[model samples]
Target: MYAIVEIAGHQFKVEKDQKVFVNRLATEEGKKVSFDNVLLIGDGDNVTLGAPAIDGAQVSAKVLKHLKGDKVIVFKKKRRKGYRVKNGHRQALSEIVIEGITASGAKKAAPKKETKKAEPKAEAKPAAKKAAPAKKATAKADDLKKIEGIGPKIASTLVEAGIATFADLAKAKPEAISEIIAGVRGNHVTDTWPKQAKLAAEGKWDELKKWQDELDGGKA
Candidate 1:
């Protein structure tokens, strides 16, 4: 079932088990929030749409948690004016777990209860963890340095960020790279992903090398 519920002055089509992030709500975690301003509802072929909002329509959701989003640094500067302003903001967010949608447009259930059970006590046993022998460093320059824009630090950053392969970098959209770059603004590392992806996609290593050379020569 799907329902269009109004949340934070915005309407959203929500379904069961779907997760949506919206404007911050003042409710505590695990609270039930019902949206009465249901604009539309659909159950298979049957669809109910309202003029402004459907009457007797509702979408029910559980507030899984409340958290702050990533810090957004706002910087304003006027060149030669000696005017500068810098501020950091983190948007408040409410992680809503859609429980269900009702035709009446009310949050259906009060909330599900959790039953905690006691664990059985037993005598503690010491478990030894042995360090495994280090494997040969199979990682090579071809594995990383081949990328037009990525240096060792950026490569390490990518690895830590869970991007491990040329295929991964090549397949990723520029916007995805932009998001990471946004996290660490002014890090020139991600600037070359486009060139790297282009080289990797076209299998043109020589062209990539020439391009890197041009960059090094300050001719780019």
Candidate 2:
């Protein structure tokens, strides 16, 4: 037989000899606890569900151990401004083993195991073919590369614009994109950017030699 019981503000269907992890309870390891508020019960073909909790129905479980979950890390940061933050956390948990359900809403059967006969082995099937390679994921619109005059300033503007990923940068607006790169070094230098962005959008990097030569000549 199996029954649904509420523990640690959560509901779970438990059966004989099953182990479960839940919120830390007041009971200690090796101690037995009986849940009087059973929400549902089932035996083979018959099933019963409770309104709030079943009447006189109870399920018993033994506290096996107390444990803690894996550590989780949280992080936050702000660009150029140099602001950063990080933290970690862990959750307490209890391990319990289901004992049995009583017919009179009390716990009855003893928790134990008996030897069983050996079962026959089944044949294994051949492995299936490998799936096709997935397409390259698209990145952001503000890809700094798409802005006409941008260089590293394109990257800086993207970050400042909150365009962290290529997918995000790909969605940037021209005016908004311009504003993000406004103060960076190259951006402050004559606006070689909007053209660079346009070149980037058309995949015309190979044709920029004349522009590069003119830029080199000016630097000389």
Candidate 3:
């Protein structure tokens, strides 16, 4: 019998005693592991397919070893510019051998129930409560990279600091925006960021584009 199963984030067709190399798992060598994400199973002319994943189905395997795969080289360069970068990476991998497959009747383990102790409630006292300030409704975040000076990292930083939408950025102080993204790489000029955001928030795309064409890296 053969079964299609999902291991880590990848899928594989496996059978009894078959060895497979997959993404690195947290299981130690010689440890047994079971996967419940059985997609399909076949035996002779009989076959069973899952609606996504089979219910009450499981595949068992034993982790053999963990190791790194072959290194891959990554290179980048900018044309007409003296910019070049080179890097290499190796993927962590694990080796495992299929032990058995259960197409059905493999029930999931029931979660253990925790017992909680009851606590006594305190007596209430009569007192006047102060009204809490109403919170402003949150707006959906905009793509800050649409602004000339903002790159992916800077955009992410701004979103992290609560400057998400174009309107929010338009209301932000340039000096504060500069301070917020000070740790990010490159010398970013924030002089035109608010103006660009203001134009974008006001739906003046043509004017924003024309103004951006005249500016360099958000500097007027």
Which numbered prediction scores highest in TM-score against the true structure? Answer: 3
Count backbone clashes in candidate 3: 0
CA lDDT, every prediction?
A: 0.59, 0.56, 0.74
TM-score of each candidate structure, all chains considered together? 0.45, 0.44, 0.48
Query: Distance from true position, residue 124, model 1, in Å?
Result: 73
Ranking by TM-score: 3, 1, 2
Clashes of each: 4, 25, 0
Best by lDDT: 3
- Model 1: lDDT to the true structure: 0.59
For residue 6, model 2's alpha carbon misses the true position, in angstroms, by: 0.7
lDDT ranking from best candidate downward = 3, 1, 2
Mark the regions of model 2 whose C-alpha exceeds 4 Å error after superposition.
Answer: 77-83, 103-220
For residues 1-220, write the lDDT of model 1, one tens digit per residue.
8877778646777899999987555455788888766766777766765544554667788989766688888999999999999977665566898887778642222121123222111101100111111112124213655665555655554543335567666666555554433334343545566657568657788887777776741124
Angstrom error of the Cα, residue 177, model 3: value is: 35
Model 1 residue runs over 4 Å out of place are: 105-220
Q: Model 3 — which ten-residue stretch has the worst lDDT?
A: 122-131
> By the lDDT metric, which is better: model 1 or model 2?
1
Model 2, range 140-171, lDDT digits (tens) per residue?
33454433344564465455333544444444
lDDT of 1 at 213: 76
Q: Which ten residues in a row have the lowest lDDT in candidate 1?
A: 122-131
